[model samples]
Every structure is written in C-alpha cells, then in structure tokens.
Target: MKQSTLSEVKSAVTPRATLLVIGVVALQLLFVVSYVGALHEPKLRDVAFGVVAPQASVEQTMQRLDELPGSPLDPRALPDEETARRQIGNRDIDGALVVRPDGTTDTLLVASGGGRTLSLALDSLTGDVLEAQGRTARMVDVAPASPRDFNGLSSFYLVVGLCVGAYLCASILAISAGARPANPARAATRLGTMVLVALAGGLGGAVIVGPVLGALPGSVWALWGMGALLIFAVGAATLAFQGLFGVIGIGLAILLIVIAGNPSAGGAFPAPMLPPFWEAIGPALPPGAGTWAARSISYFHGNAMASSLLVLSAWAVAGVVITMLAAVLRQRRAADAGSSAAEAGATEPPA
Candidate 1:
C-alpha cells in the first residue's frame, strides 16, 4: 500500500503540473496584494479643484491650498462660482471651493456623481481648512449621484460585469474549438463570434443598469456603444491570450483583467483616492478605462472620455493582431510537420 501510494503521488506531481500549481499560488498572492494595496487606506492626492474668490483673495486661497501638507489638491482659480460648476459638469474639475469675502461662511461644490468618496474627502478636507481659519463652509453637490447609485458604484459594477461576460464568452469559444484556430479563416470566425457576443452582452448590461434597475441614467445608445467596445476589448484580449498559451491563457486573462484590473479600476475608490501604484495603473487597464467611460456617459455627458476610448481601442486592436499572428504561426508549423512526415514516408523502403 505504501509503495502504491508513492507511485500515485509521483505520477500526479509532474514537473509541468508542479509549475502550474506554483503559478496559481503566485497569482493568488498577487491578487491579495493588489486588493489590499489598493483598498487598505484611501487618501486624497492631486485632485483637480477650483477656487472661486475675489481677485484679492483668490491668489491667497490658491496659495494656501497648494501649500497644504501632501499637496492633496491641485487648486486653480476659477472666474466665478458658475464657471466652477460648469467645469465640474464638464468633468474638468473634481471639486471647487467658493469663498465669501463678506462673511466667514464659504461654499464647497462637489460632484458626487463623479465619486462619492472623493467628494466626501474634499468636503472633509476643505471643511477642516476653513475651520482652522475661523471660517465655515457649506457643502453643495453640483452633480449629485442618483439615489440608487451607492457611492457611484453602479457604473463600476456594470463595467466589471461586461468584462466578466466578455472573457468568459471568449474562453468558451476557444475551448469549444481548438485553443489555436486551424487557420486564418477560423480565427476570423472566432473573432466574429466574439463581436456578436460582446454586442449582446453590452446592450444587455446597459439596459439592466439604466432602465431595468434605475441604478444609472444615461443615453441607452451611448451606453450600449461603450459597453460593446468594452466587451470586445476584453473578449478579444482573452482570445489572444488563449491563442498564445492554450488553457493557461485563461488564467492569464483572469489575472490581467480581474486580479490586477479590478482593484486598480477606481470602482470602489476614485483614482486620486487610491494608493499610488493602483492609481498609476488604473487608467491603462480595461476595467478602469471602462468604468471611467461608463461614468462619463452616465453623469458627465460623455465628456473627457477620449483617452478611455483610445485605450479600449488599443486593446481591441492588439488582441486582433496577436490572435491572427498566432493562427498564422500555427498553420505554418502544422504545414511544416506534414511536409516532414510525407518526405520521411516517401523515403521508406517497401514492406
């Protein structure tokens, strides 16, 4: 019995299997680090904020805000309260402080629709500063989040759902067929299937969030388009990963889009409020980019989303290129193998 058990263990723990297990363990550790590092403690950093005050005191206010320890806010002088509000609506600034020269009470304008946590942080920080100066400030939400949109998380969740659908659909398609497509035509067909799946998933998610759940309000068509692009980007990227690494590619896709991408996505915390590593990487990843674009569509009138769109487009294009390249390489290798086999057979002596 002992000898049989040792044989079974040796057979089960092949070198390849052992390496994959180690890889999985590493990925698990990375997931914990990414989530904890991103969410452990949130702080304000380089939040674009506006200050509206009389010409005489505007410079002083800007200077004071700039000199705050940690330099949490990037303070600029707006011409008036109206301009500050307009800038917030246009997604140019996160929050603004309006000074009342006639009295000790000031007004702080924030758009919670952008991010509730960030708006609250701005409120608290500005309030503390005002209190220290023997002044009081009133908090005003210029662009309030919908009641159902708790902490403005609906958009984040929607994007995450779309990403999950995309990768899963692509993974299923890859598994049903071979990991690498047999030829360029098969590769094209796989991509077409992904596009269709993305379209359906994207529109479904938009409808569920906007009309069905009332968690977000936006132009359904715009949301649909954004969703489709987001899904295609994720799906195509997953397909490409599968083409490159077979079954292991699925794990790689999960690692990139879920483990590393979700925490860095600014879903739970806005980019400026997250730790530096996550904040720096957020805008570049699909989940982060999709979340930003979704929020823009919902609240900011689709403003300031060009960069996010470009990032998604880059991912989609790269995925297509990589998938096609892998298919071509696979076809070439198969053809070479067949040619070698035929040549060897032709040279064999008659039996």
Candidate 2:
C-alpha cells in the first residue's frame, strides 16, 4: 500500500511541475537577497556635490571632501553660490556647501525633493566636516518636497504601484487567453487591451496622488502621461516575455520588474547612496526610470528627465516589436507544418 501511494504521488507531480517549483524557490531566495543587499547598508559614495568659497579654500575644501573615508562626496568647485543653486535645481549636483567669505557660518544647500534620506546624509556629512574645522554651516532646502510628501517617498511608491498593475494585468491576459497569442492580430489585440488598462490605471493613480490625497504635487496631466507610459512599458515587456516563453514568461517578468527592479529603484535611498551594482542598474529599469521622472515633474520643473524617459521608451518599443514578431513567426511555422502534413497525406498510397 505504501509503495502504491508513493507511485501515485510521483505520477501526480510531473517533471515540468517540479522544475517550475524549483524556479519559484530560487526566485524567493533572490527576492530576499536583493532587497536586503541593496537596502541593508545605504552608505553614500561619490555623491555629486558642489563647493563654493574663496579661491584659496576651494581646492583645499574639495580635497578634504574627496579624501573623506569611503569617498562619500564627489566635490567640484562651483563659480559661486548662484551656480550651485542653479546646478541643484537642474539636478546636476545633489548638494552644495557654500562658505561665506568673511563670515564663520557656511550654508549647505540640499534638495529634499530629490531624496529626503540623501539630503539628510549630505547635511550630516558636511556638518561634521565643517565642525572639525571650527566652522559652522546652516542647511537650506533649495527645492523642497511637498509638505504632504513624507520622506519624499510618495513618488517611488506611486511608480511601484503602477509597475505592479502593469505586470498583474498582463499576467491576467496571458492566463485567460493563451500565453502565446496565435497570430499578429491576437497579439495586437492583447497590446490594445493593455493600453486601455494603462490609461485607466494611470489616471486613477494621478488623481489619487494629486487631488485626492495631495501626497504629491504635480501637474495632473504630466503625471497622467508619465504614469501611462510606465504602465505600458512594463505590461508590454511582460506580454513580450509570455509570447516567447509561454507561461514561464510570467515568471521572467516578475523576476525583472519585481525581484530585480524594486529594491534597486532608489525609493528609500537615492542612487548615490546605493551600492555600485544596484546604483548602476537602477536608472535602466522601469521602476527606477519612472520614479526619477515622477520626482522631476513634481519638484525639479521636469529638468534632467530626458535620460529616464528614453529608457522607459526603449523598453516599451522593444517589447512591442518582440511580441509582434513572435506571434507572426509562430503563425508562419504553424502554416508550414500544416502544409507539409497535407502534402504527406496526399502522397500516401490510397487505402
């Protein structure tokens, strides 16, 4: 009886199912490793920083900052305080320290709108350095986050939500219909359905963050546009994966968007604060690009957005191309197989 029961269990769990289970376990472990590794220790390294002071002290100040343990700040000599302010607003530099020529007090300019944690880190690091030299500096927020934007994390959270909706909606379409669309028309239709979902999700998110909760302050139309683009980018990519790998593509999409993209998205910590690997890949992913663009629209006057928008656009374009091509190829193969089978039948001797 025991032997029979074991055989029945083995028959019920096929090899294919066993492989998928193993994949799930691997993804689970990766999720833990990625999140903890990127977030467990967010130390600043080579953060873009500007320095303004008398010509004599500029070089000394920059060298002092550059030699700090771990090389926290990448300091450059700014022409003046006005230039520092302009650079910060343009997102060229994360923060700046301006030393008053005749006064003992200096001013640290940080934009909390970019990332609250980053701004705080810069403030503390600069403050400690100045105190060591018997000088004091006051911190000023050049571009502040919206009062309601707690910790300046609302933008990151908003992007994360849109990304989740994108993949979930795409996965649902694959589950309801076949994972690989049968033809070009079906694939196009699937993408069209995704567009509809993107529009709805984008508008809903924009309204919630803008008028409803006031968690973030930005033009509703601009936010709506960005939100729509992000959703479509992720959904199109997910659909493309499904077209190529069938149901397994769904897992691939999760791996790319959730497991790899989220922790590296610079939500709790900015890129300069993250480790080298996560920082490097963060701007290329959907969530990271979306978060950067969202914050720019909200606080930076939409400056420094070209790179992020380009990244999202590339993903959207590539996904669409791959998905359509996959469907067309599948259709052609099916046609060829059917024709060959029919020819073989006709050549067979009549019974």
Candidate 3:
C-alpha cells in the first residue's frame, strides 16, 4: 500500500483541526451546564405584583405582602383596579390585589398562565393576608391558561419540538452532502425537502397538542400555521449556518437554541418574571416568540399573534437567502476549478 501523502498528514495534524475538536468539546460541556443550571431548582423569588385599594388599605396590603416569610412577593401599589388588571394582562405583574371598598373581602387577580407557581404563591400569601386582616379573599384568574393547557407549559413543548426538528434536519442535510451544498440545484432540492418536512411537522404538532395530548387549546389552524413557520425558520437558519460555517453550524445552533434560547425563553419563568438580560432576549428568539404567540392565540384572542409570526417569517426568509447564496458561491468555485483543470490538461506535455 502507498504511504500517506504529506498533504494528507498535514491536514490531519493541523492546528485548525485540533482547534475544531477542542471547540466542539467545550460546547458539549457547556450544553450540559446550561441545561442543568437553568432547570435544576426551578424556584421563584421576588415575583412582581400590584396592590389596588383605597389609600388607607393600600399601605396595609403592601406591608402584609412585604412581611411574607420568604420574600416571595415584590408588591407595588397601583392607583386603581383597572390599572392593576391591565398590568397583569400585559404581563407587567404576575398578580394583583383589589381591596373591596367595604373592606370585608379582597379580590386577588392572578394570571395562572404566566406562571402557575407564581399564582399559587400569591394565593397562599393572599390567604394569609386575609386571615390576618379578618377579611376574606376571592381568587380570580385574569389571564388564565387555556382549559386544555396545564402548567402553561404546552407552548414551550411545542416550540421545543420545532427547534429540535430544525437542528436535526439541518445536521442530517449537512452530513448527507457537504456542509455546504455542492450546487444551486442541490441547495434548492434540500430546501424543497425541508419545506415538506416543516409542513408535516407542523400538522403533527397541532394534532398531538390539540387532540392526543390535550396540552393546548386554540384555533388548531392558527397553531398549525405557527408551527410550520417556526419549524421552517429554525431549520432554515440551521441550513444557512451549515452552508456558511460547515459542521460547526450544528454547534452554533445548539448554542443559540439550547444554551441561550431555552433559559431566556421564559419556559420556567415568564419573561417579565425573569432577570433583565434573559427577559430582553426572550421575546426576540424563536422559543419566546413562539410561546407568546401560542398563549395569545389560545387565550388572548390572537391580539399579538401577527407580530410574532412576522418575526418567525423574517428569520426563515433570511436563512433561505443566505443558504442559497452560499450554495451559489460553492458552485461557482467548483466550476472555476473544473475549468482550470481542463486548461492544465490541454497544456500538458505528452507522457
């Protein structure tokens, strides 16, 4: 057998190759840390809430909430019940207290869909407050999750499925051919396949969420549309990454979706309830946008669905364009190489 060529040896031992391996190992380790750290405890602390009551009662309610044993509630006084309700609906606060004018009973308005733990926390605290004041508390779920939804986690599950499909499909596509497609035709073919996959995945998700699992309730058609777009967007983005950065694209996707997006997605805690950085990034990413849209469609009469859909579409379009462009460049390079090889052969001396 012929000995290995010098070029082959160099390629195998190069620093570039070693660095790539090291980077992958680092990312793999980070994935474990990120997932565990974000999900391990799942405890709530300092949840924002509002108190609405007469001038005299407001001070008493705020003091009671502040004195709760564990520092669970971060209570602020609002001017009126309308403002408090609006804040809860807009997700500015997780719950609110509307002290009755007669002072015999207080209404505890909570958004269970925002976070069940938070709601339960408020309920327990409100009960204690009522008991201390010799008053009763009536619970109201203002932004309630869908009847079919439990723990308000259905949206997270659905979005996660979409993300998994996207990255896995893109990884498969990259492995089948080169990380970057060999030609424009190949790129187009892969994209067509991705589209079909997206559609099927979308429908499957809707069925599972609506009928099989009963984890979500909404216009099935709307959910289907969201599922399709979200899957396609993430998949296309993965494809674009692979086309541009080769196999490292898989690692990049993991970093973006799993490491960064998950914790920031408000899956464990709602956006307003999260820390500043996570809160800011949450809505911009696919997971956050998808969850928000899902909840809105299911319970909010689709009030904010359009904007989220548009964001997903934008990501999809951008990914498609970049992938196609990369494929075109690859094809051009291949054509140039072929031309150069032919020219060299024509000019070669006789053997």
lDDT of 1 by residue, 46-91 (tens): 9999999999988988999999999899999999999999999989
* Candidate 1 global lDDT: 0.92
Q: Write the per-residue lDDT of candidate 2 for residues 42-72, one digit (tens) a residue.
A: 9999999999989988999999999999999
Residue-level lDDT for 181 in candidate 1: 73
Better of 2 and 3 by lDDT: 2
lDDT string, candidate 3, 172-207, tens digits:
987686677878788778888889888999889988
Per-model TM-score versus the true fold: 0.96, 0.98, 0.80
Q: List where candidate 3 sits over 4 angstroms from the true fold.
A: 1-21, 40-50, 55-93, 124-136, 146-148, 338-351
* Candidate 3 global lDDT: 0.80
RMSD of 2: 1.1
Cα displacement (Å) at residue 85, model 1: 1.4
**How many steric clashes does model 1 contain?**
0
All models: lDDT? 0.92, 0.94, 0.80
Candidate 2, run of 10 with poorest lDDT:
172-181
Candidate whose lDDT is highest = 2
What candidate 1 gets wrong by more than 4 Å, as runs, is 1-3, 348-351
